[model samples]
Target chain A: MSDPIEFYYDLSSPYGYIGAHLIEDVAARHEREVLWKPFMLGAVFKEEGTQPLVFYPKKGAYARHDMARTARLHGLPLNFPEKFPQLTVNAARIILWAGHQDQAERKRLSLAFYHGIFGEGHDISDKAVIRNICETHGIDWAEAEAAMADPAIKDQLKEETQAALDRGVFGAPYFIVGDEPFWGVDHLPQLEKWLESGGW
Target chain B: MSDPIEFYYDLSSPYGYIGAHLIEDVAARHEREVLWKPFMLGAVFKEEGTQPLVFYPKKGAYARHDMARTARLHGLPLNFPEKFPQLTVNAARIILWAGHQDQAERKRLSLAFYHGIFGEGHDISDKAVIRNICETHGIDWAEAEAAMADPAIKDQLKEETQAALDRGVFGAPYFIVGDEPFWGVDHLPQLEKWLESGGW
Candidate 1:
């Protein structure tokens, strides 16, 4: 057994959601566990002095179209959220809190959150929405709500984001296997090859 | 035959260089011809208020690594240019002129320029280097040199770039099949699937 594949993602990133759907399967194939680290991509973007990929001029429109097309090609359902790129800091806090309790079950909550926000076009930034997802996933809403504001959980996310920056993670769906880093969902195939061949 | 697949690229893009190696084979698989359109990506970058993928801080370093890794994964040779993102305006203009003379042979020249810059780490912005590649390919260097400076040939490059912008081409190695547009070397698979299924 080797170190778990580090999977970094942002809830607001559609590509992140798309990658989330498949990364586990790829990791499972190699008899490896995956550590899902959800961070605030907004903070990374602010630090990098760049915006979301879908906010550029001509590139934005093309990106939106490409997102839908990519989702379709992969047989995943995606509907663009009306309130896109919603503030996901609290959502990060929730995931961090859950993972602290049960590392194995946290992925289900993350998937539920991603599916709600991207797969169903729900607003993840809303607390009610987050609570609904948490409770639906068997997480106690009262405890999870309290944990969302827990200073330790908040610091966990902040420190995680800082560590991600230190690791040169500028985008969502960024993966780190061993010392090698792979960015974007598009690099999934290469990531699999690295796992199989142990780097080329 | 349907309309030829539009293949737009910049001389300095490594991904564009990698894409050039495989697009012809993919297009040929579908019995389609490729129209190689060379344009100044720097001009498009200025318009979009963005720079090359490898110009950003953290993203830049990762992109360089990814480019090398991706090329090796595809079994193609790649060595980073000494002077990257070189003044490729003249290289683009030369291609436009050569393509005007012979559309098919222009791709051969484009590959030659890409091989010199990325495959062998040569400085491609120099007129001597361009002339060497031109002469090696049996192209009339003197006429090509004169054509590079000709105002009409220059305008042809400008018009081609403007047309690319109008078509929403914001990056290198962009492809269009029918009314559908696909971006990046990663999307080549999806592009091929589109070609196979007509549409999905």
Candidate 2:
């Protein structure tokens, strides 16, 4: 692989979780390394002036149907998180710390956070739950928690979030390769095709 | 055809222009009546808290590129309008008036306006330009202009726009067959397929 694909995601987003697995498969197939960049979705939304829902009153219903259809189409088991719109600051911080330590560990924890919320309905906002996820991934919970509390790590996450906004990213689960940003998980195949075409 | 497939459009939108041509082709193939609905995009945006460009500075560039790609994929000629984000109040009013007079004439004018703005780089905001478009479509400009200025016609346009927003329409060039709103022009094939399946 010449350059690794940068996968920007947040743990709270269902589509981000979906793309996490799908991107792994695509990256493995193409022998491309995915540089997972977990960032603050709230910050991105604030900077971009994007509402949480596309349609206000009807968004919940539409989202449910859209997610169901997407899950069915992708053959993935998906259910709405009980504690939806949860705070993902710690999750992003841990992923950033994990990335600094080991690439595989970062990818493992990213999926764990996703599964914790989206798959198992666990409230990832709880530090204890996040600690459990860290321990399960064979990462030191104390160190992960310590790193998350570090102001430097929080600043790094903030910087990355601003960078994403500056790069024309309006939504979550943006995949960037060769300075070309693909906004949504739905555009993954197009991203893969772009990758195969020698990084457009 | 049980009921005519409602084709909702705003003249200032490039995608609406592109869709105008494609809808005609689909209607001809499926043997359905295409009801041209000319409604103000600005009014819809105001009611729905939607900005023409999603309230992000960079989105405009991404949208332009994405629209170009979509147009290319559909084999349609498209040029981004110079006075992009042009006012469509008059254009929409004329479309509503033309719809009342003749559906075919409305469709023709819709295409003409789309072509004039996106294809030929003409100033769609000009009253004379709109009058010329009406005349070119075999609509009497004086009567069409008069109808456009009628308060009742303006009220009807607002009603149509409000109805579209109530029906979960957030963007331009929306199509509705029954209760299903096929959002973008790209969904036309799927809409046709749905129609062919006898409304299952």
Candidate 3:
């Protein structure tokens, strides 16, 4: 069997939301396992010597059009979150905890967070909103919150984010098939094609 | 009938090439007309207070993947140019002159230039090569060369590029449907959708 494809993502990115849904279908087609790694985009930007908006000042406009176009392309309801660039530290921690329990649950929580943000325009930064998302997915919100507060989990998220940066990951929805890293949700199809062709 | 969509492009841009092809098909689908405007990307970047490369270092790596992925998506041979950032002054001038005679020929030459640089890795800056391309398309090479050398045509190209800068066009492949400026080739689909919905 081929090695599982590693997908690194951040909860704050709308493209990550698109990847969350689309990658599943692509992976299923290739019969590839997916390793979901949720990390901090802020830390990645800081380490890369850049700011998010500085790279593209017209990002706000582009992002809006991208969401609409992506929605039309994928038949999904994609709206901007009320408070964008939401604090996803707690969300990342919870995802890490869920990954320890069940990979499927982790995937579920990832999509729920995305839907909550881009679908309903919810304040993902709000702890209460995250708790509600957890509850909707049959996740234990109390335990999830407790795990988020754990210093070890906080350190782990930070360490993992640093690891992503060290791996030359500049953006979310980055897919690493071997040593080659394909960044952005747009590259998902190419990753699948590579996997299907059995090419390194 | 609605006003034609004004397309601002630079001959040296790979994305502009992709956009040129995609927008033509999109216009055909929506029964819309496109007015092609060839401009200088270097001058536009200077006025925007940024260089395209400086805006995103990751873009270098991402651009390669983007080309490959877009090729796979569109099923086109998108060979990246060897000598990028070509002296597009002559190319832009020829395009402007061609636009006066035959708009379709101007569009065809623009695509041919894109293919020459991006698909065949040719040095489009070479006058001989440019002449070869012109002659291949049934254009009088001497007349075309003379038109390119005309001071009035050269000034007209410069004026058009400057006009684009004044109108907030800071990037290549900018599309203006009425007063709204849609920058970047990726936004072509949205521009098409907008035009289909009766010009936003």
Instruction: Tell me, by TM-score, which candidate is best.
Output: 1
Candidate 3, residue A173: how far the Cα is off, in Å: 2.6
- Model 2, A123-172: lDDT tens per residue? 88899999888888788987988998999999988898887777777777
Q: What is model 1's interface RMSD? A: 0.9
Tens digits of per-residue lDDT for model 3, B1-200:
67677888898877787788787887787777888889998887765555654246564666666666666566667777666668888988888888776778778889888888777878889998898888888778888999999999989998998887776677878888777667666566557667767542
Q: What does DockQ come to for candidate 1?
A: 0.80
Q: Enumerate residue pairs that collide in model 3.
A: none
Which runs of model 2 end up more than 4 angstroms from their true locations?
A: A2-4, A25-32, A58-61, A101-103, A189-200, B1-6, B21-35, B101-105, B185-200
- Whichever of 1 and 2 has more DockQ, that candidate is 1
Q: Which ten residues in a row have the lowest lDDT in candidate 2 chain B?
A: B53-62
Ranking, TM-score, top scorer first: 1, 2, 3
lDDT for each residue of candidate 2 in B68-144, tens digit (9 for 90 to 100):
76676567778776777888788878777766779987877777888888877788888988888877778788888
Q: Which candidate, 1 or 3, would have the higher DockQ against the true structure?
A: 1
Clashes, model 2: 0
Instruction: Please give the range of 10 consecutive residues that has the lowest summed lDDT in model 2 chain A.
Output: A54-63
Real contacts recovered, all predictions: 0.74, 0.23, 0.03
How much DockQ does model 3 earn?
0.19
Write the number of the candidate with greater lDDT, choosing between 1 and 3. 1
Q: Candidate 1 at A131: error in angstroms?
A: 1.6
Model 3: lDDT to the true structure: 0.78
